[model samples]
Target: MEILVMGLNHKTAPVEIREKLSVPANEAMGFLKRFEQKRIFDEQVLLSTCNRTEIYGVVQNHAEAVDAAKRILCEYSHLDLASFEDKLYVLKQPDSVRHLFSVASGLDSMVIGETEITGQVKEAYLAAHQNRHTGKVLNNLFQRSLKVAKNLRTHTEIGVGRVSVASVAVDLAEKIFDDLKGVRVMVIGTGEMAAQLLKAMTGHGARALIVSSHHEERARELVREFGGEAVPYELFEKKMGEVDILLTSTFSSHCIVTENQVRSWMRARHDKPLFLVDIAMPRNIEASTEKMDNVYLYNIDDLKEIADKNKALREGQLETCAHLVQAQTQYFMDWLFKEFNSKIAASGS
Candidate 1:
């Protein structure tokens, strides 16, 4: 069987397109189950994140599998196939394996050397394995990729500095406020990203933090740990006028904060500058909000500029990372070829 990867990422497409193709973590398992029922590939795993959505599988016919994967993605995302065809990339065999290793190592991320993608990749693979959608080939490939990612980070200086989206967001906030000492920050969700943002903001001496989530208990827990006040989800908007930086990452299909809502809040604040950082996939704030004066809105795509600067700082580490990726890819390819040859010999005997 041939290993294949078909997908698009932040480099290949814009945020609008990437958001449309994203499969939320909660919905990934059910989507994988439906995708497997179609029988396009023997084993499959879907890796969806704010930056990219990739479908990896083992199949007999590479071309047919690529087409089927694209079709399934279009159906699931409700996006037209014609719209994505130009943006999509298809990789086979060693190239596919190399791409997976690079992604797991965070070389493929907008913020080069960011470590979050490794966990995202592991989670996606585990979901597929637990549902029995993946067999020996994919299981081995993902497991090895995760191992290579760990080794690369441990041995190299790839992740030595500010590389995550959370750190970058804090960096941007610092630029606008000049100092976080008197900044009043409000986090809309208590997810991993939210917690990271809180920690970074506090470390920078942000004066206050307010945590709000659909789940009150989770929000309160985060507040307790981070030294913030937990506000009821319904009242989060009411506190908007008092907030200088609004960080949001909620699991909502639609925008939780709209232009009209922010416009009304701005009136109360007398046009105080509001920095909005939307780190969610589906996006918690509406795109139209960016047009408002004194409203600084940054989405996942907007973070790319900051990430690019950080990438430049780590340019010296690229050669070392490339060497690690090459060595790991060769190791996986040798094992894969051996497995394939052994299966052929067994069949012949």
Candidate 2:
């Protein structure tokens, strides 16, 4: 069998296209079952995040598997195969292993050196492994990739700065308000990103903080940890009019904040400037809300400009990261080859 990776990411397609293919963590097992029914590969791992969706697998026939994988994606996304074929990329063997290393190490991320992808990759691997969708080949590959990621972070300067989406959003908030000191920040959702945003905002001395989430306990926990009030989900919109900055990262399928709602909130606020940062995948805020006066709306893609500047600043560290990935990739391939040869000998093939 051959190790292969096929997918599209932030670099290959825009968020609009990427969102169409995103598989939430809760639905990963169902996706794996569907893919298994197709028999595309002997073992496979599906990774879907805010920025990318990829399938890494060990397959008997690379050509057949790739075709089937594409078919599966098209079927699930309801997107025409022809429309997205050019956007997909395929990598084989050592190159595939190298790409995994780059991704786990954050070198392949939209924000170069950002650490969230490491956890996301691990989560994907665990989901597959726990469900018995992965075997020896994928188990070894993912384990080594994670080890490489840890070594890269330990031995290099790639993770030295505030390169996270949350940090960038806070920076943007600071730029808009001139200072976060007196700003009333409201965060919807209690995910990691929302927690990070709350911490950053409070650290910068934001006057008031309010957190809302589907899970009221989680919201209250965050508020207790960061000195904020916990508002119930039903009242998020009603409370929005009083906030100077609104940050949302909910996992809802539809937009939580709409143009008409914002218009009403704006009227209530007397046209106060409201900076909205929506870092959700399907997007928590409506696109039409961007047209509202004095309301600044930014999604994950909009943060790419800030990410690009940070990427340039960290360009000097790329050579060191590249060398580390090359060394680790070679190490992984050598191990894989030995394992493959040993198996062949044992089977007398």
Candidate 3:
């Protein structure tokens, strides 16, 4: 069997293309199920994040699996396959295994050696397993990749400092404000990142928060946990007018807050500083809005740069982690190749 990965990533494509190709979380299980039904590969896993969407599978025919995945992804994303086929990087066999191991270990992340990719990798593996779409090949691959990631964290100091996007935002907040004890925060969306940031921000003596999300239940849950007030999405502007900090992470495709919206909100505070962190791809806040007085806006890439700086601080340990990934990738390929050979022999070819 041949293992392969075919997809576009943050390094290879802009958010416009990345977002267009992402599988909606609500639809991943069904889409994964449909892929299994086609029997295009021996094992498969699809990883979708703000920065990337990758499909990994082992197949008898590399071309067939690539075509199938491309078609399925294009179908789900509603994009023309021909438009993006040339843009994607397709890795096969040993390179595919190495790529995934690098990804799981965060060597391939936009911010090299960032820790969140491990959880994202684990989530993708769990989702594939829950859908019954993964077998021994992918199971071992992802499981081992995670183990390597854990070992990397242990053996290397790659993740020694502030690691997550939430944590980094909190770090930046500390730089801007002398103390968060009196700062009022407003979280624009109740997604995972926003929720995590809310938790991080709370410890810094944040005065209050207004949680606004499309899903009221989720918003209420986060509000309760973080000791914040829950509000509907419609009340975002109202909350924006009252807060010193705004952090947004949502699944919305369009800009939720624009320059005009912030302009009006700014008038209420006489241009008091408002820290805006837009963690979502296709950014929830408008880029133009940053030009407004006292509005500090940062997107995911900005945080990623901060993350890269954090990663660079631990360069003494990164080399050791790289060696570990290389060693583990080789070991996995040995077992994987042996298994494939045994399968072929059993077929009496």
TM-score of each: 0.62, 0.62, 0.62
Give the alpha-carbon lDDT of every model. Answer: 0.85, 0.85, 0.81
Candidate 1 lDDT over 256-283, as tens digits, reads 8999998998889899888999988899
Lowest-lDDT window of 10 residues in candidate 2? Answer: 340-349
Per-residue alpha-carbon lDDT of model 3 for 148-256, expressed as tens digits? Answer: 8888878777777675677888887887787888788888777787777888899888855655555778777877787868766776676776688888788889988
Global CA lDDT computed for model 3: 0.81
Q: Write the per-residue lDDT of candidate 2 for residues 1-349, one digit (tens) a residue.
A: 6889999999999888899999998988898888799888889999999999999988777789899899888988999998889999999988999999999999999778888999999999999999998999899989998999999889887876565566777788877898888788888888887788779888898744555555788877877788868887777776776699988888999988889889998999899788998888899899999988999999988876676667665777899999999998888878877879765344334
Off by over 4 Å in 1: 163-199, 203-310, 342-349
Q: Distance (Å) between predicted and true CA of 309, model 3?
A: 5.7
Clashes of 1: 0
- Number of the candidate with higher TM-score, 1 or 2: 2
Alpha-carbon RMSD, candidate 2? 12.3
Worst 10 residues of 1 by lDDT: 340-349
